[model samples]
Target: MQESSEVAGSIVSEDCLDEVIQEQIKTLKNAQTAALSAVTKRRNEIFRLMDNCDNLHLVKSEVIILCKLRDKYDESFQQYEKHLTDSSERNTVNKRHSENTASIDRFITEMNNWVKESELQLTADLDRKSLCSSSTTRTKSSRTSVRSARLKEKARLAELMAQHAMREKTKVMEEQELRLKQEREEQEFRLRKKKEQLELETKIAMSQARERVYAEADNISDIVPKDTPSPLNPNVDPFQPQPSDITVDTPQLKANVPCSSSHCRFPEPNLDMQLQSQQEMFLKTQQHMTAAMLLPSIEVPKFKGDPIEFATFMMAFDARIAPNASGDADKLYYLDQQLEGEAKDLIGGCLYMSSSEGYTSARSLLSQEYGDPYKVSMAYIKKLISWSALKHEDPHGLYTFALFLIKCRHAMTNLSHMEVLNHLPNLQAVVKKLPTYLQNKWCSLAGHLREEKGGVDFADLVEFVYRKAKAANDPTFSKFALQNNYSKP
Candidate 1:
């Protein structure tokens, strides 16, 4: 029985030991699960830290690349700015240079024009002098011819006188011869008549005596008498001359006769008539010669140089031909017809110069010289203005035209005003191209146009201002009015 109890005790102890071991095992298992959780959390934290470090490296590399690009952009921007600045400066310089060149060219051109004008003027003067000299020479030659003609007429008169005297002397001699012949014929006729009368008387006496003797004898023998042939029979009186046989001698006239000096007197009345007829002829010839001398001879002088000088010379010559009178307008008109082509154009330009001088001056000059001064001056102004506008490069032409417009402003009409307006843009361009002083001067005039008022037109105002200034003896105002009045609208 004792042994059985001990065995049971050992078995109980063994059960107890088995139970403690199970409890300890449960505790260790719980500790092991908690430590595994802590290790896993640490590993996850390490992995998260490594990922954050890789992200930072990537971000830093990206920032470095962006910084380099920004630096490159800044450099490029600076270069672009520098290039733009340089280009701008260069452009400005080129513009300046071009303007300088243009101004210099303009000045040179103006100088050349002046020189050419001077040369032309000199040449014209020479031509005018030459024409005057030629005219003088022609007059001298005409006088010489007239003197020769007079001498010839005198010689002819002397020869006619000698012929008349000789003819008169011959007529006297013939008359004397005829008178002497008539006297000799009368004396011969008287002598012949006396001889015939004596013959007839003798015959009558003989017949009577014979008849008485026969009467006594016949008483005894009448028959004897009848047989005898009577004395009156046909064959009787044969000694008497028949009428057919009778001859009368005529007296002969002598052609030659001696003349007394007194009978050969000069024929004074006939001489006077001949002299009078000759004087009439001489007077008629003298009148014709005088008319020829009085007539004007047109000789247009040649001028190769200045048109202005030529115009002046031509005007003077024309004046000499016909004085400035309304009646002489046709002469001026015909004179223009005689000019052709370039000569006419040159004359027109010279007329424009007169227009530029002043309206009053142009009026006086043209009125005296041309048939229709107003019409001619207007035409000239139009032509010049057109030429200047068409050939825009010539500043001299423009300047001259502008001057003409200013001078003749008072003469402008609606048509002229329109013409001025049409060319305004071109005129402004030309004005800008002028020198600084000119520009200021023109601008001042333009200001006047803006300030001007009243109902008076631009043309009338110009005339009034000009006259007023002149009357006031204000040279500056007069000059300004002359230069600027036409530029006003």
Candidate 2:
């Protein structure tokens, strides 16, 4: 009982534990109490037999009642400590927890102690039964001795009565012996009848108690399994599923290369022949690798006169082909190859100029016309203003809108054009472009941010919108879970 109290104490304070477990402990602590605990106590259970030392009904009855209480206690405790952790009380040491759990631990400990003490008392029971058997054995033995002596005396009388009548006297003695045997059988039958009557009464009492248990609660049968599990090992893991074979279907590559049938190899080659073959093979493979490099891994973006596209196009051109080109002439040629429509024609005159001056002239013309930070930044604002109002605040549309805002934010980052994006009027216009529901969410978010930082920025709204958009996306989306999405305050 103390150990269970200690386990419960580790979580809950003494006061809360008292409120929850004190009531139950009160019932069990006293032998006079008529609760479940007192009913299944050691003295009245399997430890001792009935008064006659014949009926085992008390043992079976105690076992059944204990099992019922065990189930009820298990359910109550499971609900109590299901997800309750002691760590939650780290900041508040006085906080009470696991109120139901305290009661469960108390009941389990009480039952386990009952079982233990009963086993000890069983030793005394064994001695008592042995004594009962010895007494019955001695009485039966004395009766047998007396009957044997009487038979001996009768045989002596018969011998004195008849030498010629010996056969008739022997028959008469046999009849007397048979009569005595019948009388002994009648006595044993009467004892058996008495025991049977006692057994029937015990069975009736047990049946009435069982019916009362059923009448008290029908769900009791459902809650308690036939072969009840031990409470100590409640956390035992169920059988784990074994890993199964995984099969993947993929497109198989087929041969497209022309097969060679030269049949040109020699088992032993002259030095000149081997040297020539090696040189030819190495040069041919090197040429093939160089040809492979000419095919671009990333498809080049075709830029028109749109300033919005200017920053990304220039960044891509600069990263991939521009730095590798030793001469400006090569850079200009690659740049022209990546332009189209208004952008290509805008640099047409410079393309015809001499290589030395042509590249510089074309490059400056393109940057001046399409790569101005102010122009690029204005284009982003224009995009936001021109964005069509959403028909509904659906996850896909919200996600798409969030992506556009994110792109604008990323583009303006290096350009230092955040002042335009952070303008209150511009932010309001962006919020206005949202569907009714999201507009409200954005307002709430903006209010929260304004309280914290005095004002909300484009980055803040983008982050806020992106989070909700991602969270509202379907569970089939592999990237995010709702808990993970909204984890931060």
Candidate 3:
């Protein structure tokens, strides 16, 4: 598809260039005709002028002017000729380009036809294979029954484990909730006690001030009772014209009042500072919770601790169908397998996230997804890791397992280098340890990814991979691979 598209584009470009050259040729011809007409008119005028003059001096002067006019016309014609030559060269090049385009188009069309025929043949072969397999199975019904029984047993075990994990998660959540409630109660109690202490201190200070005032009054009575009026009878005798009845009043102290927590006004918090703190806390809490939840994930069973199960499956499936027709059967089978993985990843990733709330959460994500969710989590992680830089930390075997996802061509198209590079610290460590051939293959893949759309639209990390691969001269990327044009966007 890509090669054909490029061939088509080249054809169009050549056509456009030819049209431009044709226009230039037309312009040059017009200019040449104008210059020739001017030259002819100038010669006629000079000749007539010479005839009208009988003097040799006049004739010589006319001839001299005519020579100048002829020279001017010659220069103009020479320039026009040069332009015409340039136009001709352009036309030649355009013609060559058109011929090359026609050849490419022919090749592309033929290749496309071959591909279509190959696909049809492959489909027919697959159908034949299915019939054969079915007939063979009919002959071995006992074996088929045994295999089915084993698969059912495996499924039952898987379901049992999943249920156990869910139960454990529920218990863990209950415990967490209880702890949270206890902490909340403790915090509330502390706040209540602190408020009470503040109110008590206020009351004690107010009582002491009242006592001091009472003591001062008692001392005044003890020292000057004779000069002081009676406590009550002095003010009662309003008819008495006593000078003591006009006694001056002393300054009275105001008592301290306790403030109510319910009505006490608090200064508003600084919006910027408060918001910053909230955001920081929220981020920290979110990360902590996510990490904690993920920690209990169930371990995915491995194929004898092998990390290349998916890769092996795809390659094997490809090989199985490769002989059918131009590898179309293999491509389709692998594509279907790839789609299954993606779908599993979606279902399993979400389930793992849910199960991660407890002991089930702390286990390996890959294991849980494979068993309980029976899905792939890489796709989910890919989206997350792309959006945030934090997904690269401690990318273990499960992280590498996620790479199986790149087989989904469309999914790969949506990713970017920044998202991939963010995981570079981990990827680099893995790449160095990989066999040279595998490393080369990875780099070649990376280069194709980069060049696919005139530079990788997804991730930039692969450019580094491209450089390394180029330096290593990986077999996966030959001269042909580099020169092979891709489909137009």
Candidate 4:
């Protein structure tokens, strides 16, 4: 019986020891699981903090969050240490447990201080950086505003300067234009004044010229008279009485000579027959040369006792021979007895006698006849012409003889036997002595003779005149005769 009871006690004691060991192992395993979970939670918390603050976003707040996390981890570690120091947990065979606790405690302490210091430094840096950024932004904005104000002021000043310059330039141009217009007006005024002055002077000069012309005309009118005759002919007296000595004497030798032939012979001439024939001939030939008109004879009244009166009475007797002669020879002899000796001699001296009346005379004895009375007047004219050549006479005498012959030709141009033979040579000689201008006068006389006598032998007389003119000493007479040969007689 005793052995059975002891065996049963040993079995029960063994069962109790096995149950306590199982409980202790369960507690240690739970503690280890809690510690591992806390470490994993803390590592996840650190990783989240690091990720949220990568570019320093909210740096101070992030650092503060990290400190709090470190504090939480430290408290959890202390609780783990308390669990480990319990008597039953102390005698347990947990290996390297104190070293693990101490390592966790040191890590928690370093993390807490690092987190506090990081929070403080981060806060100071953030405050200083914010202040520097605000100061830089304010400086930039001030510079931009100042630049805008300066640009506005400069634009206003430039606008004012440009306006002032334009006004000054416009004013100067207007002044210059005004000055130019004034100068132009003054120049025009001067030109107008000068034109008016010149016109006035021209008018004055024209008036003076007209006045001077009138004055000169008046002076010329006063200097020369318009109607005065040339002053030269007061001394000539055509009616003066000729003296008794003016008688032409006849040569007795030629008066008595007998004729050599019938052509040279002439019948004796009585005053009455001679005057009748001459009057008939002169009436027939009066159309030829009429240079002078012979005046009619009248009876002289008896004036007694003055010698000058007697001489005048003789002139009257001589002048009347051609008119008073009659066809009766006895009546002419009685009429010759009535005159004084000087008067009868003067009657005989005449070469060509004039008939005072316009017709032939009648028989007379102290009875008057009317015209040229004798045919022998032509014969006497011929004798007178021949005598002029014999005497070296003056041209005036020959001119007087030519005038007498011209009258004789007018008295006898109708008579068939009537001849003017002696007048030609003397007329030619007188024409030669004359100047060319006087020769033209003789040419007129010769032309008169040709018309009256109808057959006057003037070619010989013209040739004679031409020869004398050529041989003469006068140049004017020679040249005129050479140039006008047909005009000479």
Q: Pick the candidate with the highest TM-score.
A: 2
Could you give candidate 4's per-residue lDDT for residues 1-489 as a string of tens digits? Answer: 799989998889988977776666566556665655666566456545544323344444544554565455455544544545366765552444556556556755665565666667778888999998889877888888888898998999899899999989989999999999998687667656755655565556555655665666667556444444445577975567768866888655463565343344334335455445545554444422121122222556432322324434445655765355664353345444555544344344221233322121322211221122333443444454455341232444444544444544544464333344435664465455456654775577667877888644634344444444344424456444465665777
Q: Give candidate 3 regions above 4 Å deviation.
A: 1-139, 223-225, 228-489
Per-residue lDDT of candidate 2, residues 1-489 (tens digit): 999989887867867776666556444333222332443463344445433334444555666666666555444434443333455643232222243335445654664565566666776889999998889877997889999999999999887777748878889999999999998788667656755655565556555655654554455444333443344565878768788698668664344432233332212224455445555655565456545544535665879778988877988888888888988789888888899998999888987888869888888988988887877777788888899887563667778998998988887667777468888888888888778888898888778888998988889888877887787775855244565667767
How high is the CA lDDT of each candidate model? Answer: 0.48, 0.68, 0.50, 0.52
How displaced is residue 263 in candidate 2, in Å? 60
The numbered model that scores best in lDDT is 2
Worst 10 residues of 3 by lDDT: 389-398
Better of 2 and 3 by TM-score: 2
What is the lDDT ranking, best to worst?
2, 4, 3, 1
lDDT by residue for model 3 (81-166), tens: 55544677657645653564464346435434544565566678789999988888577978888899999999999999999999
Candidate 4 C-alpha RMSD relative to the actual structure: 65.3
Q: What is the TM-score of each candidate against the true structure?
A: 0.19, 0.37, 0.20, 0.22
User: Who is ahead in lDDT, 1 or 3?
Assistant: 3
lDDT of 1 by residue, 75-156 (tens): 4433433333357765764565356446434633543454456556667878999998889877998889998999998899
- How far residue 53's Cα lies from its native spot in candidate 3, in Å, is 99
